[model samples]
Target: MNILLSGWQALVDYLTIARVISLIIAFFLSGAISTFMSKGAVMKYFGPNAKKYISYAIASVSGAILAVCSCSVLPMFASIRKKGAGIGPAVTFLFAGPAINVLAIIFTFKLIGTEIGFARVTSAIVLSIIIGLVMSILYQKGEEIDPNENMFNIQEENERTWWQNLIFFIILLAILISGVKHPILTIVFFVTLVVVLFLYFKKQELLNWCSETWILAKKIVPLFIVGVFIAGVLTAIIPETFMVKFVGNNTIGSNLIAGVFGAFMYFATLTEVPIVNSFMELGMNKGPVLALLLAGPSLSLPNMIVISKVMGIKKTLTYICLVVLLSGVVGLIMGNLVFY
Candidate 1:
């Protein structure tokens, strides 16, 4: 009874923290993205006939800046695809956008260590590019969509100046940095963001934007809470020995298995950090940790379900399998040569 009660308490705490933080970050980042990054620019440059490798490289860097989760990238993926991006390049952007981002890398470094942090970034970039190349070759003659005709443009009429956008970006960075240690600071940051938006834009426009952001939050925050609660329960119920037995040696096989499991498991945005921390306490090896880092953010059960609805089960499965295999292979090599 005591154990169950404690688990329940932990679940509530985790859910509260994760949901609040996720919502705040999501709203702020999404607003900033919609405001600053121009769709015209993206289409003109990364649109069709763009060099496959070059597109991959650009996508990797741009993705790092967005700081979104796997599911969050879906709309952006569809947008770019409609804007004339090839299937392979668009898919690379889809994967890289969430997989290898500055936020995830920084979080890993702060929670884990410098080595794992570097490895995670390296693997995300390399795999994104490689996967993009292979997918391009395989689907070179696949269905091509015209960007101008089909892309969704959710842009609002009001636009901010370049300087204002830059300022907003800087504020977001500051908020994220401060939120790492102090959760309350996030609230302050958000309030300040709202105030800034109100001052800069028309009242009606700001209200509409806030309403949309709230709608998105309502949809995602509840799921995030549930996920965190489940993670907490798993932490309390699962034995440490189980984790140690599989991922303790940083061995090639162990890392591969870990990668496969991570690919299939659902990790809500930023939830993997605490989960990985729990596993580390159980003596999970660095190799497996690397594998998990590579696979977790890019692939998830809920994400797969949603993707399958749009891309069909076959393509979704292929994507998931490829992520697992590639992450496992890279993690194995890095674990032995660099981390060992």
Candidate 2:
């Protein structure tokens, strides 16, 4: 009964109106962006033959537009990888597609300290690129491919006018950026987006966006709720002393533990932020918190399975190892240098 109540309470607390609205809008915004970007655009920017800096840049920031969790992003990642993206950029996208999502970043900044939030995001982006580069360099013989063959001929290329695109993106951005601040402002942006969708966008486009949004919501929201409930239950069961004794210090072992644990546990969207926050309150050190944040969303057991199927076991194992190692190093450095 106590565990049931704990889980129920967590579900109730997290399933608020504001959170629901934010989730819906964020998923819709991501859907719209992905539709606009298309397979061809992803190939152009993230293909193997693309300039290294440009590809990595795109990969490192792809999550801002994707808004998927580690496991959820695997299909998209595999699609691009099979479509001809270099192992490096594709791996970067795999990490960034979940790590740098807007909801996660905002929630971290809001629920945690400002500096820690910034560090989490920065370290995630840098480490994602590093992992990608290392994987491409190490697995070049098999992973290297021609970008031209990967490029698809998009029939809807440049279909929307520049102004239409600008307005669409601006409205989505406004809604997302303001969702964290004022409720009224977010509503206003949402209303404006709806109006633009009806007036400017084709009926088919609107329907497609809605379908994609629903797909994303169905895939994410359920797991996210379960994860939240489990996190709450774990917090209740685990003694504070245990957390402090094991992860209270900013040591190499502690950071590695956090990273390894996070790599194995699945986190959906912003779920990791709150779970890690609970761990922090239980006496987990700031550095280990960052380590968890860095690895948690980008790598999980389910995520690993999907990636292995796509990239082969050897490549997937190498990527996971790299992510864990780099995450630990970043957390250790941050712990010692920044906050201590």
Candidate 3:
């Protein structure tokens, strides 16, 4: 009964107003990308034929604009992948989206040491790109080309102009960033969104957007809830003392354990900063702390389940291994060389 109550409490804690709003905005924006953004546009930057320099650079650093958690970014990742993005850029965006978001980085700098904060940002971007390039090289030939590639070679006449779409996305992102924290800004953005929809978009187009959003929500939300509940149960079962004991030294084994634990555990948005700081206070090594920082935000049990459904078991497992390996190795380096 106590364990059950803990799990229930965790679920309640996870469903804060700000988090709900963020998820809603993420859902809508993902739907908008799928419904409104043209295949040609997605392909131009994220497709297989797209320039590696441009696609990897954009995907690697794109998280600066988004402040979502690992789970919140899944729908958008799926939307782009289905819309004709190649595996490499899609993977890059998936890892970078949550790992190096502006809020997370800033919070790390403020709560954690500036050294770890800078290291997290630099390592996340670099590791994401390396993982993306590796995945691209491994799977490029095996990637199934979209059958409609020829049709999307040119932008459809019905698609909104690029600048118009950009403005619309900016407004949506504003709502996401402000959320409930800035109620006034949220209201203003909402009103502007309505105005833009009425003036610039047709009723049918709006309906289609909502429909796509609903579809993504249906596919991801149920699994997300389950994953969250399970994660909560794990948190209740795994004592913090046990984790702290093993990770108190800056060794390869400790770093690997931290990386693996972080990969499977869920950390909501900037929550990892405080959690990691608390661990450091408990005598956790700087190396394992860095490992957790790298892996915690980018991958989670719920995140893994959802992405597996989107990308399949093989690709999902491979992504997980790369993230865990790289995070551990980097954390080890940071602990031994940079800090020590």
Candidate number achieving the greatest TM-score relative to the actual structure = 2
Model 1 per-residue lDDT tens digits across residues 238-294: 788887888888777888888988988877665676678667767788888888988
Candidate with better TM-score, 1 vs 3: 1
Clashing pairs in 2: none
* lDDT (tens digit, per residue) of candidate 2 on 1-340: 7877877777788678777676777777777775665555554676556688898988898887555566667888887777787888889899887888766786687667798989988888888888988988898777557657436444455667778888988988788668756879878887888788777778887788788778876776777677778767877888999999989999999999999998998777778876887788789999999988998888888888888998899998898898888888889999999966
Off by more than 4 A, model 1: 9-31, 34-36, 43-46, 51-54, 61-68, 75-84, 100-122, 141-159, 179-209, 301-318, 336-340
- Which tens-of-lDDT digit does each residue in 3-27 have in candidate 3? 7886677668767776777778877
TM-score of each: 0.74, 0.85, 0.63
Q: After superposition, how far is residue 267 of candidate 2 from its true place, in Å?
A: 2.8
Off by over 4 Å in 2: 110-114, 141-155, 180-191, 309-314
* Shift in Å, residue 3, candidate 3: 16
Backbone clashes, each candidate: 2, 0, 0
C-alpha lDDT score of every prediction, in listed order: 0.70, 0.80, 0.78
Return the clash pairs for model 3, or none: none
Model 3 segments beyond 4 Å from truth? 1-44, 147-244
| Model 1, TM vs. native | 0.74
